[model samples]
Target: MEHITSVHNPRIKAWKKLQRKRERDRSGLFLAEGRHLVEEALKSEVQVKVIIIEESVELPPEWQVSDVEVIEVPEKVLRELAETETPQGMTAVCERPDRHNLLLESGRFLLLDRIQDPGNLGSILRTAEAAGMTGVIFGEGCADPYNGKVVRATQGALFSMHVQQMDLEEAVDLCRENGVPIFGTSLSGSTFTAIAPQDSFALLLGNEGEGVDEALLEKADQNLYIPIYGRSDSLNVGVAAGILIYHLRGD
Candidate 1:
C-alpha cells in the first residue's frame, strides 16, 4: 500500500478538486468522507477508485482485501481530504454512479423543481428512499445531490436511490405518455385527504418559497395540498415531501 504524506501530492490535489461542482462535473467523480459513507460507497454500485485511511487507523477487514487501491495517509493528509471539521479518519474517491429515469411502469416517482437547499434535497432523498419510491428527478435549480453537505445529510441513502436530472416539462410529458398520474403540491391545490393515491404516479415538489412552478403545476394531472390548520403558514419542503411521498406511495 502506498502512503501519501504531502497535501501537494498530485493525487491529493486532484481529489481535493472534487469538492467543487464544476470539478466533479469535469472528473466524473466525487469525494465520500467518514468511515460509514466510505463503506456505503464500497457496498454500493458506485466504483471507488481509492480509499484513504489515516495511518494510525486500523483498516476494516472488508477493505483490507478489496481490489481498489488503499492508501495510508498521515492525519493531516486525511484531514485535507475531509469536508468536516473533525475527520472520521477515512474517505474515498468514488465514480459518480449513473442514475436512470424511471420507466412509466416503474411505479412511484418524485420530481423536485428548484429545490435550492442542500439540506432539504438530502432529507427528501432520505425520505424518498425510506418510502420505497422508484426514483427522483431533479429539475432546474435543485441543489446538486453530490454536494458534500447533501451527501452527508442523506446518510448514504443517496447511493441507494435512482436519481435523474432533466427539464421537468419533459418529465411531465414522459409520465403522461406512460399513463402515470402526476400530482403537484401547492397551497392553492386540493387537500391531500381529498384525493386518491394511484399505484403508478409522479409527484412534483417545488421551490421553498414559490411552491411548485406555475407552469409545471399546470402540467400535473392533479394538484394536491396539505391543509395546515396551525398558525404557521407552510411546512418545510422536506417535511412536505415526507408526508406526500408516504401518502402517495400508499399501503
Candidate 2:
C-alpha cells in the first residue's frame, strides 16, 4: 500500500529517466506499461523491482503481487510514465529480459539486416514468433528492439522469443558454424520455387529501401525471390519477410 503521487518525487524522476536509452542501459531496467505487458513481464523470468499501479485499481490475477514493492500512483503520474496515448494506468520498472541466442544452438533462424523501421521489425518479429522460428538476430544496423513502438508492435512476443543483436557477417558465420545455410530475398535472385532448401535454414532479410548488403547477399547459400506480377517491383520488407518465413517454416 505504498504511494508515489508527486511528479517531482525522486523515484518518479528516475522512472521517467528510462524514457531514454542511456538511462535504461545504465540502470539495467526498462519501463513496461499497460496491463498486458506488465503482466507478461511478471510472468516472465525477467526481474521486476517495482510496480507502480494506479490507485484503486483491481489488478488481474496474474500480476506480480508479493515479491516486489507495489506503489500506488496518481493517474497523472501514470500518464507520464506510459508511452501510449491511452495510458494503461499501470507501469513497472523491470530488468531487461534475457534473449536466447539460439543461433549458437538451433539450425533454423531469421537474420534481419539493418531493417531500421520499428513497425516493420515489430511485425516481422510477431510473425517470426508465431511461425516458431528458433531465433531472431538483429543485424548491426537494425532498429532497436526495445524501442517502444517495436515493443508494442510485437504484442508481447519479446517476452517469449529468442532475440539477439549482432552484425550481419557475424550472424552468417554463426549460422554456418551451426550448420544452417543462409537464404536472402532479392530481386532477380532465383524464384523461391527454384532454390528452395529443406526446413532447416536461416533467412537474411534486408531494409525496406536498400535491400541486403551485397557482401552478405553473396554469402547466401540460397537466393530466393518472391515474384511480383503487379507494377510494384518489391514488397514491403515486412510482407516479404512474412511470406518467406511462412514458406521456410513449411506453412
The best candidate by lDDT is: 1
**Where is the poorest 10-residue window by lDDT in model 1?**
97-106
Residue-wise C-alpha lDDT for candidate 2, range 19-105, written one tens digit per residue:
887887687788777787778778877777888999967677765578888899889888888888998878878888666445454
Candidate 1 — which residues are off by over 4 angstroms? Answer: 63-65
| Model 1 agreement with the true structure over 71-157: per-residue lDDT tens digits | 999999998888899999899898898766456565899999999999999999999989989899999899999999899889899
Query: Model 2: residues >4 Å from true position, as ranges?
Result: 62-64, 100-105, 195-197
Best by TM-score: 1
Which residue pairs does candidate 2 place in steric collision? none
CA lDDT scores, all candidates in order: 0.89, 0.81
